[model samples]
Target: MPDHQQRIAYLLARYVNKTCSREELEELFAMIGQENGPDIPGDLLEEIWHTAHPAPDIDYEQAYLHIKPVVPIRRSLPFRKIAVAASVLLLAGAGYWWLSAEKKTAQITTVQSAPAPPILPAGNKAVLTLADGSTVTLDSAGNQVISQGKVAIRQSNGQLLYAGQPTDGSIHYNKLTTPRGGQFRLVLPDGTKVWLNSASMLRYPTVFSGKERIVELDGQGYFEVAPDAQHPFKVKVHDIEVQVLGTTFDIMAYRDEQSVNTTLLTGSIRVNKGSVQQLLQPGQQAVANNQDQQLAVRAADLRKVTAWKNGMFVFNDMALPAILREVARWYDVDIVYNTSPATELYGGGIGRDLQLADVLALLEGNGLNHFRIEGRKVIVLP
Candidate 1:
């Protein structure tokens, strides 16, 4: 039988690396449920589970702070060699070298390791710029009305709401922007609930009174459009336009992506780009290329697409460059990498509430990778 401590260590390594099998994860979960299993802290256990299975109920901030990683003890030599050397030094010191030489050798062997600092968790907030060029920070309080032509813009509950009792068909535009380490939500006049991810921007009219409601987007956002049979909600990203009557969908239209992806969660939507048009159903996605004017429809995992709204950072076969883009936004930090393109296809989950260190630990669990922090920047080494 394997030693219990060795078994636990292996499981811990597998869990951190996101390489645990389902059965292994189940066993680890069972162990965590037990109060007498190892000396593992409750907070650290929660962080491990939350990273592997992120849900809306998980408190990312708590998990982020609770999971304290154990730094490896560093010596000038390997642990076995150090132990042998220490024994030899003890024998030699019995009666040979002078007291001062013996003292110096013992001092060199007195190993000291680095201690990690407490991790800090963060939340989301952003700014909204009205068509008139006035800015309103969403996280701040005090109801102030910003005039964007006839539209009355008000911020409440971190959401930018447009007063609906407008008197005309006049058009007014507003832009919602999420800065680094920030996010915001909005309820448009049409009753649509849109959640903007960090480092993203959205431009929409103050009122959607016309036959076609249109909006523009950059970065990422999740949209829950209210039913308006007469006036379809249309989202314009670069050149592609997503049209729907009433549906919940997530759109990834970041400028860096090779293809713009629109994933539908409920109801239906149509993607139209100049001469080409493609329709999508629930759990479906439309990948459109602005450069080539080509569109392809395929099945999509709805949870993975809308995970951001649920306060998670779930990735399925995502590239390292893409993953860092998201990590930089939520943590409000920059990344410096000194490694080959990550060839490993990552398939796992993590909550958005995790501290920067908590996330780096998970990434380092994977072999051939390590991370360090310098000021506000995260450096990835291999």
Candidate 2:
């Protein structure tokens, strides 16, 4: 008899190869359903990433997006590795990480896939509101430079960039907003790079000057702050402030989310909430709980935190409700739950470039829940 690990490995290989019998598929899912899932090694994951090739249908760039879940999720399964396998083999035409493809890829979802219009994924779309209150539709602007007062803002290749302008001390504010099902990138006057996620907003000055550089954030963004030790950079999110000299970090502060999370990738930062302050090192995260009005620090999940910027929807041990919120933002859909979901922390991810039906298929094959789509509304089923 094979050991548990050996059996899992065998079943997974067979599943990928589309050679699994119904019984074997049931057994495989049952094993994963146990209290604790398999423990795969990190090196093996790296090996899979380095050697695996995508199926013929998927292009190299598309497969690369799915294969790049670098950080481990906070779950029993090091599903980050499985995500690699899923991307190369399954998500090319089938499921997320685990599923019985409906066809050669092993059809898996319980969601009704009758002929219907598909909801496409988000792209480089944002509305830039200049200091003069004039708005430029960035997605259609292509590569163009628009002048706002004395500053010249450049929009190209889905990015908004501008060279550092000398401030006349007039201090005008410009806002960048990513609508639902849209995202955008920006290069601030000081060379700081900002990746705005879906339904997020960032407000900044026309140029860097005075004692410090500051920006206000309303939803989510990943920041690679330009190094300026003399002039610290600070991000204002509600009541919390993340202050740093030069560092790469991500912040999630959606109005619907329960907590405001700040994950630091490189360099050090100080997170201040009123009088309470916490210093964070690289690979650390500061979480501000809205309900209790408290702040705490812990090790960060870099992959999960910055997955949006990387072009994957990686979720680890997240509940259905929370995951749907992400889906709603990126796909611009409403979630209507006909059945309350089990409180299990499911983990998996797919390339964000895929459509809504593809994403739901990936999630449904996990054996936790399924979905039904009505127009722009996603009806969650048990």
Highest lDDT scorer:
2
- Please estimate how well model 1 matches the true structure, expressed as its whole-model Cα lDDT: 0.65
**Stretches of candidate 1 exceeding 4 Å from the true structure:** 1-122, 140-150, 165-169
lDDT of 1 by residue, 238-341 (tens): 88889999999999987766889999989999999888898888989999875797899999967668777877766655666777777887787888887765
Clashes of each: 1, 8
RMSD of 2: 5.4
RMSD of each: 13.7, 5.4
Q: How high is the CA lDDT of each candidate model? A: 0.65, 0.76
Would you estimate the TM-scores of all the predictions?
A: 0.69, 0.82
lDDT, candidate 2, at 148: 74
Model 1, position 77, has a per-residue lDDT of 23
